[model samples]
Target: MARLQLRNLEKDYGGFKAVHGINLDVADGEFMVLVGPSGCAKSTTLRMIAGLERVTGGEIRIGDSLVNDKAPGERGIAMVFQNYALYPHMKVRKNLSFGLRLKRRPAEEIEQATRDVSNILEIGDYLERLPKQLSGGQAQRVAVGRALIKKPQVFLFDEPLSNLDAKLRASMRVRITDLHKQLKADGLQSTVVYVTHDQTEAMTMGDRICVMKEGRIMQVADPVTLYNRPANAFVAGFIGSPEMNLIDADLSGSTLSIGSQSLALGPAMLERLNPKAASALTFGVRPQHFSLVGAGEDNALEGRVSHVEFMGHEVYLYVNVEGQQMIVVVSATAYDRSKIQGDIVRLQPSQETAHLFDRKTGENVSLADLH
Candidate 1:
């Protein structure tokens, strides 16, 4: 396995810079995922690592060797693309053996490697079938097998599960993670760099996830840290399922005024806020962090129920608080069925979980204590 490093890596398309100077380190045998929305340069960064795209500046290192000038084939990295990228005319056996064949490995070694990969992927039955004959998931497995057979120092996946259906994608996520573990157990090179726009995939698969935006790295942390202790406003809003509610507000002492209404920032939260936080800041809280409270609750924000969505055991309550929309998740059993649209409700934000951010910079000012 190899430890991958990108130091001040950059890429530009003539006049436009697609990747900013971003530095990241992927430890040997680690699964590092680069995730962000479309046009975030995640794919560009992955391509740079794989030597598929030329870096305009900075260093690309695999293990102890600098590989910025190396060809893709010489980088000791194997890449699995979004599309299977398999030769349609080639049977699975040939496709998996193509890399080894190009190197002119022994015929006996190629045959043994093919069998081993096929068994591990459980695609042994379709070894003789053409790429057209396999299902989306099956074809993806073959693609992974092709890379696996190379025994490269690192594995790079560019949204490898995007072409599959939801169910298939879920299954493939587990399969790939398990395969990485199995390979590691067998003393094989199992370092992986996965690029995807899907937050679910990143949260579930990565040992540590790097969130990016506008060609820059936002935050790199484990899933729990990303969720519970987001470093900034962008990350606070992006990593959650329903996404965190980021409302514009004016902070005064220990109170936040949103439109015509105001909520008190409790002592616990006030203590954590950075002293330099601007008066104009964002009030960030997740749907799950808000609780349904009585109408006269002291610190609760009053609003009218704009909509209600019953999601099995949980209900998503959409409220319009002084012209600002906020979502609160409550247990189905606890939610008042009699309360419908237009009904007034009080939503209380959790003091420990609520975040305050600088309006201009999107910096989570309330994260001073978290670090």
Candidate 2:
């Protein structure tokens, strides 16, 4: 177990900066996830921490030791990659013990570590089977076991479940979370750094998420903090499911208008936004935030229904409002398509959950002023 710190971390190729200078402190026994779209330098950041990729300029400290110049094997970190990277011809047990054998550990000690890892990973029955004979999930477990046999100070996972089928990937997510819990209970002070493009993985597994964009860290926050209280337009759009509906907006006196509908921000919403925010703002509302308001000047939106998709759990209704496409999610059991057809639909951001951003800077003036 180790406390990992990346100080002013930067990575560059020739003159192209892949990751700009950024700082993060991962507590001992913490699970931190790095998430973003491709070209965000998440993999490069992970490799740098593991000493597989050299830092362009910065310091990487594991526990009390500064290991910026250490070799990959000397970094005391284990990396589990997307490809599994298991030897097809080697048995699972042999694969797990390969590193120990290379290090010249005693045969008995290597055998014990191999047995312990296999047992913890629940692959004891497949110990004699080769990678060719194992299922995708089993192969990934073997890969994890191989990393565990080394017992490194930190665990690094780079999209480890990307190769598996969707169901297996979902199952592995739970298994990995359970594994972290068990390992912590056993007194291993391990730090985990996981990198993935999947928002679901980022929201579920991390103690803190580092949201990246174009080589810069946009925001570092807990799942709910990043979701309910985003720092910018990019972070808001990147983290949520179905994404938030962003429309060109203006605030006139006390009313916030998006397209043709005027939203009653009321005293609650007004107190939430910038005091000076009276005009020229962007209205950001999540799909689940919209509600059918009563007739008259109350919450209402006139739109044309473009399409509808039934998702078993809920229904997604796509409507064209003010020349913008807006999607709304509703319980399939509560309301059928007949209730939300060509009639003038009324929608409001229930409980004042909508977000407002600056038209130019994209800064979350609404949230920033409140804090």
Candidate 3:
């Protein structure tokens, strides 16, 4: 196992900066995930650590050793790519033992290693089969098994499961996580760095998730913390399945004006805001935070139902508030569309779940002191 550290790491292509100065520390034996949309520089960051891309500035270290000057093979790291990259003519056994063969390891040693990995991955039955003869999931296992044979200190995965179907992808996510646990049980210290565009993958498999946007790191935290207490509006909108609803509002002392409606700020929330510093703000509320309420209830907003999605046990309501669109989620058992009056509904946001952000900076004003 190895501890990885990036000190003001940067990458530039002529005049274009692909990665900005960023710093991160990954503990030994940790499973860290880098996730973001395309063009966000997550893959570039992973390549830099693997020695596939040169750093424009700052240092890259692995286990107290500077690796910026080292070749990929000399850095004690193994990588699995999105395409699997297995040889077409090579059988499963040959693909897994290819690296060791190149190093001229003994015949018996190679046989033993191949047997162990194949058994662990449950692919022993197909060792003699070529890559073309295997299914997508089986081929992926061979690719991962090839990397495992190297026994490197760090494992890097670059969207290794993106090629599979939804069901295969879900199963592979669990398989990879279990593989990590198996490695630990076998007393092999293994550190992993995974990159993906899927937020679900990051939330489910990572020990900690790093969210990036453009060329900069946005936020890094455990899944629950990232969801509940986002550092900024971008994170609040990015981490959840149904994105958080952000509405423009004007703040004056303890009163918040959303369109033509007003909500009195609770004392705890009022203490967190500086009225003189911010007049215009963005009020954020997640879909699950809004609940159905009586039309005359305090802090309730009246809206017409634009659309409704019946999702088995839960229902999502798309509401048009004035000119803005907002989404609300409710239990299907508690809400029935046919009983509504004039297709109009009253939704109220729980005061304790409200999030306030600075309109100009996009920073979460409520969490100013926490960061």
Candidate 4:
């Protein structure tokens, strides 16, 4: 329900900067996700937004208010931690109603709010149960319910599903997204800021994903845009499931030479390239974009199959192109398992799906002008 803005937000610990100067504006009622690997400053940023960690510099604003100097409770924000953070001695009902009780709300109002949150989260049956008696999923629901009862202007989640099993994580993801939609449908301000290391969660849950690395923002875009038109090689390699294969190649005029093979570039690619400069570039192709081709096919990279992995409907082939290893995905039904390791195969990358990045800076050269 609130627009969140972090202007030049920074966090430093004893001269060591954990978060650099990063700027972002989250629209009102938007679901934003911060995704990256470990030690990427995602949790630190979330904590700063929640007023749990003091900012080293810059400002943290919620709606029209400057909340940099406000305490966590006064900032009108509720947070759900990764570990559930439930009080072991308190029952589910007490845990959910604790915040309201501290504010000294009326008894009937607290009861009604607790009931509403319990019904929304489907944890009404465990109202009398303690945290120790509940399953991991149930405990997580209580933790979220605790935050929901507050009805804060902004919600912050710090890897809230990391402790659950794979199936539970998927189920919880759907539940959380549905909850967000329901809140929006009911005309409530339910802006959310979620932090997760899993790209799957970021892709499915976020309206816009902010990809971070080494305490800096890399790229922020919708899931499809980030996948199809990555801003840089780091974003391209980090967002995809079977990460994009980046191969070193030489660029000359309208042709790209990968290893000993040369592939002609299309007009669109030629327009994106620097015609006067023939330099070393990184050619990126996704696994699914590579197709099987005959030995005599043009624009094909010939390589020996180094390994084969069957993944239900699709198979991933690990091919060795000279000294470099590349992965190609093919339908399991169409692939011949008999041709295993050491088998020679030719893969032709789709020209339209190929990505070109500057070798020196790791920036996507193809998208330089567009972005």
- Per-residue lDDT for 171-288 in model 1, tens only? 9999999999998898899999999999999999999999999999999999999998888999999999999999999999888899888888888788898988899999999999
lDDT of 3 by residue, 1-371 (tens): 48999999999999999999999988888899999999999999999999999999999999989999999999989999999999998999999999999999999999999999999999999999999999999999999999999998899999999999999999999999999988977878679999999999999999999999987989999899999888888889888889899988888878888888888888767766654447788999999988888756787888889999999999999999867899999998978655457889988887677789888988888764664
Q: Rank candidates by lDDT, best first.
A: 1, 4, 3, 2
lDDT of 4 by residue, 75-108 (tens): 9999999999999999999999999999999999
TM-score of each: 0.97, 0.95, 0.96, 0.96
What order do you get sorting by TM-score, best first? 1, 4, 3, 2
Worst 10 contiguous positions by lDDT, candidate 2? 335-344
Q: Which candidate leads the pack in lDDT?
A: 1
Computed on alpha carbons, the lDDT of every model, listed in order, comes to: 0.92, 0.85, 0.90, 0.91
For every model shown, the clashing-pair count is: 0, 2, 0, 3
Worst 10 residues of 1 by lDDT: 336-345
Encode model 2's per-residue lDDT on 241-273: one tens digit a residue: 988887778888777777767766776666777
Model 4 / residue 215 / CA error / Å:
0.8
Please identify which of the two predictions, 1 or 4, would achieve the higher lDDT against the true structure. Answer: 1
Best by TM-score: 1
Off by over 4 Å in 4: 274-278, 336-342, 368-371
